[model samples]
Target: TEHEVQRWPLEPQGSTSFGLSRDGRFALLYSEEHHLVLWDLEQNKKLATLGELDADGNAVSHIRISDNGRFAVTAGQMNFAVWDLGWTQAQGLWSISDALIRDIDITSNGEQVLLGLSNGKAIYVNLVTGRRLEFLAHREKVNSVAISPNGRFALTGGNDYKAYLWDTESGQLLRTF
Candidate 1:
């Protein structure tokens, strides 16, 4: 698939991940060296830069914007943090185990975040309460995780080569593959 392309070159501080807001109004590119640049896509220009997430030289694994574009999630090796798009610093919404986080997913309602750990366990955290929700399924290194659009269930695939379904509330195994 060949298509026309254009390029504009600018120097950004460090390694970064790009995420587009749900409404497409804003785009955020964050760097590993503790900086994030917000661009206004419609205006075709850089809007603002926030000196946030300056924790370590740890590379960011994933960046996710909430469905409404009001919240954002950033993942690093030791810790994961969530930010309000309107502000530079992240709100104290949730935190994960210091086990080299591999992946992160936010619910459409912005009520929960699912984190996949390098040690093979997947945990769900409630944004409002900052509590780790009960999760029971994976027995080995979890390779991937997904949640239903309605946020009723989660599916996980891992080194075990098995996919499992679990209830979001009770953390009970609903099915296995």
Candidate 2:
């Protein structure tokens, strides 16, 4: 299994995290200082670097890209932000109330964003309208989350040692393990 693709010399210092668009055309890398960088994979060039004013002042825990590549989302320092890549001036931005976002997943259509929080909470937001669909509480922080390719279901794992499957459209708890 050799996917050995071209390697770009990323940042030399600072703990960082990465995210790839669903279609694999775009990517994002963040430094420990909450520095955000957008990369164009197809062009193999750096597309944008979100400056200090654009990124949160502190470090981020995780990041995710929408399926349609219209938006980029990140969680950090008690904040969850949404970025509109297509817009030129400070794209769309928003914050979550509880701010425990640890891991995130986007729907294939890019209309919905799901977040797993550090406080054992799960949040599902409708990106298109910036509305919250569900706020699920857990006993421990959520560690990871994934949405089915078909957009039919979502699975979330938490430090509470549990995983849950939910209906994407209806926001119903489908199963738990």
Candidate 3:
């Protein structure tokens, strides 16, 4: 398959990780020095660079951009935050107590953030209200998580050798396998 490649010629020189929004218009890049930057992929421009997070000072390990390009969530060893793209501020910032977040995905409509934790929990946070719904999905570490394309359901997998289907709105367990 032929694909187009995008490059950042002046991209900060360091180990960096980025998350692409579902629409492929934006990228949230985290550098080794714990710097977070928003890039406009469609226009090939740097949109915004957030100030250093003085809360924990830890490097972000993972990032996920919502489908509608409205939000970007980032997590590190001890911090997790949801950025409001419109305002360019972290709308919901948490000093996480459990283990680090292992993986993340956003609901199709970009209203919810699904998180997989190292402490065996699957959590989804509502961006609008900053409400969080959490449950013990596994006895061991949760390794992966994904939301249904319609934004109504979720699935999670973990070290416990099982997968779970959940209702996003009510945070109810629908099935376990």
Point to the candidate with the largest lDDT. 3
Task: Tell me the lDDT of candidate 1.
Answer: 0.69
- Evaluate residue 5 in candidate 2 and report its C-alpha lDDT on the 0 to 100 scale: 69
lDDT of 2 by residue, 1-177 (tens): 889766766666754678888788888878855378888888878888874323437666677877777776666746656676776224455566675668887665556677787777777777667677664746888889886645567888987788998886777888889
lDDT measured at residue 131 in model 3 versus the true structure, 0 to 100:
87
lDDT of each: 0.69, 0.71, 0.77
Candidate 2 residue spans exceeding 4 A from truth: 1-6, 32-34, 52-56, 88-90, 128-130, 135-137, 148-152
**For model 3, how does the per-residue alpha-carbon lDDT over 146-177 read when each residue is reduced to its tens digit?**
87755678899999999999998887899998
Task: In angstroms, give how far residue 32 of model 2 lies from its true place.
Answer: 4.8
By TM-score, rank the candidates, best first.
3, 1, 2
Please give the distance, in angstroms, between residue 62's alpha carbon in candidate 3 and its true position after superposition.
1.1
Candidate 3 Cα lDDT to native: 0.77
Task: Report the number of clashing residue pairs per model.
Answer: 0, 3, 0
> Least accurate stretch of 10 residues (summed lDDT) in model 2?
87-96
lDDT of 1 by residue, 102-158 (tens): 777777666677777778788877777757764546677777777665566888877
Best model per TM-score = 3
* Pairwise TM-score winner, candidates 2 and 3: 3
Ranking by lDDT: 3, 2, 1
Residue 161, model 3, lDDT: 98
